[model samples]
Target: MKKTIIVLLTQLVLGLACADTIQLETGSFVTITLPSGWSANLNTSRSNEKVYWINLISPEKNENAGKIALDRLKHGWAATEEKFIEHMSASIERLSASLKEQPVSLNELKTDNAIILYQVLVWEKIVSMITGAGLAEYKGVGVIHIRYNSGHTAMITVPIKTLDNSNELNEILNIAQNMQISMPLSENKEEESAQSSIQITQNEHGTVIGNPDISRVSLLLPSKNYKATPGALAIGRGDPGYFIGRDMVANVIMSGWFSPIYKFKYKTARDLWKKDTPKQAKNLEYLKIKEWDVMVHELEIPIKTQNTLQVTLRANLLEDGTWIDLRLSSMGIASQRADMRKALIDYINTLQVNVAEARGFHLKYTKQGVIINAPAETPGSLFIKTKSLLLQKRKTHIKTEFFLFQDSGEDIKVIAWLRPASDYHYANVKTLWDETRATLSGEGFTVIGDTDCQKTRNWDVMLYDLKTGDKRTRNVNMRASCVSGGIWVDVHFTTVDQRDSSFLRSKLLAYLKNFKVSDSHVE
Candidate 1:
């Protein structure tokens, strides 16, 4: 009795250790237990054309006793159920040939949950493929092919008890048909809940918006439609109104345009014109200008309007360092001189100011000059001067003075300018040429006067130079004025050695090539 009890206990332990259960729940729940020393493979196929799920189970100890479960029902086929049945039949026939298996017989069995039709198969050799797996029936192995159709068609195979009759086969079919597969909806819900738990915080005390150091005054001429051209002024690293932080300045300008239009020019003009003239002037006849099919009663109206707009945006970097300022002005149309003046004032109000610790070696501005806060800097002081001259009839000239300065430690200066052929005031031409020479000489370049000169159909070109009061004369160019495109000037590096000079020169050329006078500054 002791020996028999010990043997029985050992068999029980082995059976418990070798048990493997697979549970599925598409609708009804069902489970199957297999020996522990077995492997299972699950495969899925999905595309725009169709979707399928196949599960294969095989014993590791008895390699030939593996079975496959396949589901091939069309995802949505209620309208053409016959087509689905035909497709399944064709698919199964092809699959059987591919597996080198001959269907032994088809048998039907009814259970408490489902009525199952199963095909028994016996093959001479096992075939392994990506689509399906086959197994040979040995002394104790049998293959049971079970297929069903509901929302989908599924086929499963398992080893049959060689000695048991059809009653045992029917029992396996009942369990397989009633098995359920769970949907992924619960997993999706859990993921969404996890994502919702995360939050983001913004720093409120870091910097204030809309403060600017330099301001801009924008004038929009009356056109037939909304048209955009290069602005009257350009700002960049090298331009006359250049800003150090190009991206910040560009953003502020663009934001100003997006804001609602305020007709401050019209309002200011009307206010000034009203104070100067009597109430009767309101009814006086005036010249009309047409823009966008809208008529303005006065050729020169007071620069006051209800739709004028301006904006100022600012950023702060540190408590005591330099601040960035950006001012944007929008003047729609100014009828009179007073209107123009008032519009300028209103536009300047849009300037934005920002403060930040300096990152680069020096702070430079075309109009404010250069400020050297660090002495060990190599490039030293760089200054730029820009002037726009309006020439009429090739004789009359109007020169606009623009200044450049250095925070006084440097011993040298360099100033470069671009003269358009359209602005040749004959009287001031000689004076401007002389000023260019004097400026270069004062900076220490040997004056090599007129190294390059050429006259195209549109304009004339001239080059001059300044050296270290020595034999070397740096070549500079001046072009005679004619009616072609407008001219621009670029001056960089008031004091620089060969290395620094080349660096500054490259930076200036890059600015000119990419720079635009238009509102769109960077591409």
Candidate 2:
């Protein structure tokens, strides 16, 4: 299906960024220069043409100050600074109407360099009422607008908390100066329709491999070939998949491979693709794709039928140790086997990857915590909670950051608590756990076997997988660690339903594989 057109635009969003800067595209009017460790996400799309919301992200681990959105508006170029500022004030007012809090103060700027007209707004914040006193902890909200030619305007904003100052907004604006507008990507619907063409011609010839010259990843098709069924990229939803073809009649197994893994370099392409394969596969041989060395595998049996199919896959290693694997199958029909094999062989021989040089992945800023290369996650719904709380007292402080993501109809949670190691007088993790175990549960928590306590990235660490609570309460799967005198962090997931224990436990373990605390996030 033409399922991937709009979706493909953002697939390469975080890949291959270079030279101390990351690029961000709104898929609308602007693409901006994002400094390293900084990320901006599209917040809301408005029917007002080019008007939209882009969130400014904080690099801090658990800065849940709520969303700070920059309003972008496109209009006719302002004849004077006065006109620009007036336009900006009106835009802010229209946006502010939907907000719980209203703008209380607005100011215009007179600058030495007058290429851009500017305005900044300070807003009254809504307070959370407690017993009798309101939690007036919010400092206020600050917004700065920059109006430029081409009828373009952008703003940087934040809900300033008492602990954070106005300088936070200033620092953000200074960073904004480095941003350059990115040209809009073409939104031709034809690109979407073209993806479905791979499946159209079926019953007589082999699959029509996409053209090598015009395609993103190059390969050739037979002169008279059938089109395969529709498939999405296995790694992401609605992304283009490798065309699957069998006997020109009906193909059972269809698949593709995607990698952001400059991380798992030495692993064979079979090693990567096998993870998503429906049936167990066995490594078969190693061969050469032109000058590149490739590994091969044969799927044991992908689909069950008397009419059997033989599927063999080959992958080539790129210069940087990355891999691109091609999977082709031969049907049980004797005549079709040779035709499919010959077509696939010719296609494989001509395969060429024309992607950007691989770079390590980027970090995504979720509302509660930052994700280290996690894919599109719709967090904080009824099924999840992206709640983050920062607590402080006379001498103790703790930041409890929660990221709850559900997969396979089960809730998976990561609750991270960050505290200064000095709270425990810089005690070894074993001692701290021995002491804190009593505080978390009346029954006491169990320490998983051979708890790992190793220093990594300047954090002296300790880890214990703990479990406690009875059938009446949720189960806790937790890890506790200390970074010498700097901080102690605990990450864990609590199962919501008692019946989900085993399934949740296994999923939690798999989920933990992607969980990481960025060293920059450590206080």
Candidate whose TM-score is highest: 2
Regions of model 1 farther than 4 Å from truth: 1-104, 110-115, 130-150, 159-171, 181-523
Candidate 1 has an lDDT of 0.29
Q: What TM-score would you give candidate 2 relative to the actual structure? A: 0.26
Candidate 2 residue spans exceeding 4 A from truth: 1-254, 259-286, 291-311, 316-326, 335-338, 357-523
- Residue 170 displacement in candidate 1 (angstroms): 4.5
**Candidate 2 residue 375 C-alpha distance from true site, Å:** 18
Model 2 has an lDDT value of: 0.38
TM-score of each: 0.22, 0.26
User: Candidate 2 residues 1-523, lDDT tens each?
Assistant: 1000111011124432443333333122244544445554543322111223455555663343223222222211223456666655565564454232345356554333233333333233322211111224454445565654433445555556653455556645554443343222113344433323222232244233432211223333333333443322111122232345433533323343322123233355546444534333444556666744554444322122233335454554443222234455543443355454454455556544443321122222233333322112211111112222111111113332233222211333344544443444645556655555566556554643444555444334444445433332234354534343243445545443333444545545555544444334211
| Cα deviation of 352, candidate 1, in Å | 65
Worst 10 residues of 1 by lDDT: 2-11
- RMSD of candidates 1 onward, in order: 35.5, 25.9
